[model samples]
Target: MAIRDAGDQPAAGIYGLSIETEPMEAKLAKALPSGEGWQYEPKWDGFRCIAFRSDSSVDLRAKSGKPLGRYFPEVVALLADLPTPNFVIDGELVIEVEGKLSFDALQMRLHPAESRVRKLSRETPSRFIAFDMLVDTDGMPILDKELAYRRARLEDFRERIEADPAYLTVSPATKNLREADAWLSRSGGDTDGVVCKRIDEPYRPGERAMMKVKRLRTADCVVGGFRYERDSELVGSLLLGLYNDDGLLDHVGFTSAIADIEKPELTARLESLKGGPGFTGKAPGGPSRWTTDRSSDWKPLRPELVVEVKFDQITGCRFRHGTKLLRWRPDKKPSQCDFRQIGL
Candidate 1:
């Protein structure tokens, strides 16, 4: 894919607006923002997509302004078939498997081969959950309009196109804080958390004008291994693992939120039990695009120690990001730390 600079002139699409228009961003908040003008919606855990339909041509752009048309051909075709020929909609591109959203299936669409992408699209078709509209069906840009007016325009646009909830659907939003809290409490398998936006505020492009709170959960995991600091011998991160149904421990994730004052004693304590195989099922991998040279240089442990970790999302049986070290789970046994705790 060709890289486009942020300052470059965006290519024009429907309603004379660029298909690669910068998406509005959200600031991560510890708690949901409460106010009179706040509108809450379920934060879908999928690819942030800005879809544009210009006559027969449809373009799907990622939040980073990268072209996603090749990855999701079914979604492109769905938009092209809409009754409204010219429009720009902001939403998420999600894939569902077994009646639940599977982010791993959505990531599989990023294949380089077109044949493989087409095969996966057939096996696991994706859905476009519409949330916002930048261009109306009348081919007019509504960037300066308030979100309350824009949402009405989006609903009318969806009605004109007669979007099917199975493929193309409008996302539900509410103004009540109680309903928003309920959505956050039931967040899992489908929604990630809750996104609160100002109903009276105009569209602010490429700005953190919205607030988002992610649903966090805790899990007990076995201390499978430990990685040392870049140059020092002190412990840096603790590799976490959980036992599978087959009785083999798999590397789930790691936590590096250790306090500096405890590194000396912790390093010494970890070094004493570093001889056995750490994770019997899946182990840490070598250096990759997201890893350092010392990522694979980890010392295996006896899997006797257990630790509690706080995490947000898990994809393909592994934590999506580095976990937060909560506390030592000395009261919890290594065998008690299994995938069932995470609803595997």
Candidate 2:
């Protein structure tokens, strides 16, 4: 979550677009907007990136305004070699594994070692899926232009430059609501969900001018462990686990959405089941760069309780984010909660 200061701006700039400029964001919605003038695109499962190229200088920036060039050298090289020199684009940085986009592979490219990054780049090369054009090849600013206009220009720009479709691809977009819904229904693997944008409105950087509906799904998980709230004995979060093929319960993720009124009784119930080994394999509280003294403290459970939780995405056999507590499942056995539920 580190933010780069103004001093960190690069010496070379792309048109007038700075690397510190934030990309236009999307607000989450339950469904896509039903009306005309709305364009829908596939919500790619990757990093939101802004790619800039001017002459021989090229830069790749994350949505948080952090530099990403070093981590994706292959993308940088691709942009530097492009026939079109002066241009800025909004895209997603993705890596495909076995024909499906892998967020875990993209995350692995962030290693500090150049040798490790180079090896991953060759083994699993990244792709830039362009969805917006901020600046045209003629140095014409496109931010003030309407989405419809910019999208057309982006298509034309792609053909003019002859950008390598393998590395630099222009994302497909549709105005049909049924098509968008179909994309959402088939959302998995490479596609995360659907993104809806106002075709008549201009690009508003750092603003939630677009809407996104993530493909959410539910799963049954074992209550493998629990963490106490900081400075209090009340239960904080329920650590969720799923049994692998080897019959070992591995910590997939946690859900801290427990209702406050149920904490005292839940805490008591958790304490009673804290005797047996919690997660037999790949347990939580592992050493991580984001780990802290208080965050690492967790109590083990007997793995007898089962709860159904809602999750959006999974990476490396684990939930990419904390899940939402739905309700206890007395009808389902803990052994029934396996990796197959989440398609691991």
Candidate 3:
């Protein structure tokens, strides 16, 4: 994949996609089968990063190919200060406190001020838990090599690097399926799910070369305002609304994991038909049971996008978990995004 030029654009987080980036998805298995070709590992709950190091310069990019260097200055400094400075690595960016991953600390890295970022870098710094070796010290891509070989190379590199609890580390993997299953079940803390990869498979960059299993669930939502991350950009999140008999677009939920990456572009095309009373009935009123004064954060848009979110659970009408971001259906009208989809 071609390297994207990192400019002033917001580092692609959940809403953006890297130009060469492929969505990481899993193929559903009719039944969980055991096989020699498969190797399972604990899926981590953290940011996906591709670290590019060239001599003294290091760029930590998000899965969306956005430069994450600013958000993680300590990671950049650590990578630049590494023993080998000309290798590219793929890994998860996480913060482990008391041996458990802390995603809240990771989210704090998204601040806008450089001074604050630098300060936080010193205090509560981040760690790069490497899992794959994309490039070797010779500046050649090694993604075509088998997983066993890559694991050996990664182990060697980890051994050579200076250990900094806040900046760099290695992610451990187990080949035992039961152990992997155990990690999947131990929730409540930080384990996101389980990822199964082929031991002999070569690193298929920009491909869904692995299988991910998460505890899947679903929710019903109302389509509210559709905000574009940027002007002319595709819809970022479908501002979800719920209704009462009075008829209004109430700020209730949002579905961002629309599987259709290009769906937002199509949604923009349909905005021309937006002027009608999108949500009629009792719209979102004051703060709900979970929110505070932020109730006003919502905006009213023409109700035209309806989506069913295969989510985990709900705190209220809002998803208490990170949504999988499924695909968009033009076939389903806006009004179809309703409470019936909400799990009982």
Identify the runs in model 3 with alpha carbons over 4 angstroms from their true place: 1-33, 97-99, 216-344
Q: Can you write out model 2's per-residue Cα lDDT over 57-153, one digit (the tens) per residue? A: 7777886666788888888888877787788899999898998888778878768898998899999999999999999888887999999999999
Q: Which of the predicted structures, 1 or 3, would earn the higher TM-score when compared with the native?
A: 1
Please give the TM-score that candidate 3 achieves against the real structure.
0.61
lDDT of each: 0.82, 0.82, 0.61
| Model 3, CA-based lDDT | 0.61
lDDT, candidate 3, 1-344, per-residue tens? 12222334433331122223432323323223366777666667677888777665556667555567888876776777777766777888887777788777776777788898888878777778888877777666677789888877888888888667456767768777777777768743666567778879888755545776655543335466655543434555556665543444556555555545666565665466456565465444433343231333334556665544566556655566445544433323344344433421
The sequence of per-residue lDDT tens digits that candidate 1 reaches over residues 34-54 is 879999999997888888776
Which ten contiguous residues of candidate 3 have the minimum total lDDT? 10-19
Ranking by TM-score, best first?
A: 2, 1, 3
Provide the TM-score for each candidate, comma-separated.
Answer: 0.64, 0.65, 0.61
Error of 1 at 218 (Å): 13
lDDT assessment of candidate 1: 0.82
Model 1: residues with Cα > 4 Å off, grouped in runs: 1-10, 217-344
In order of listing, the candidates' clash counts read 0, 0, 16
Task: Please tell me which model should have the higher TM-score, number 1 or number 2.
Answer: 2
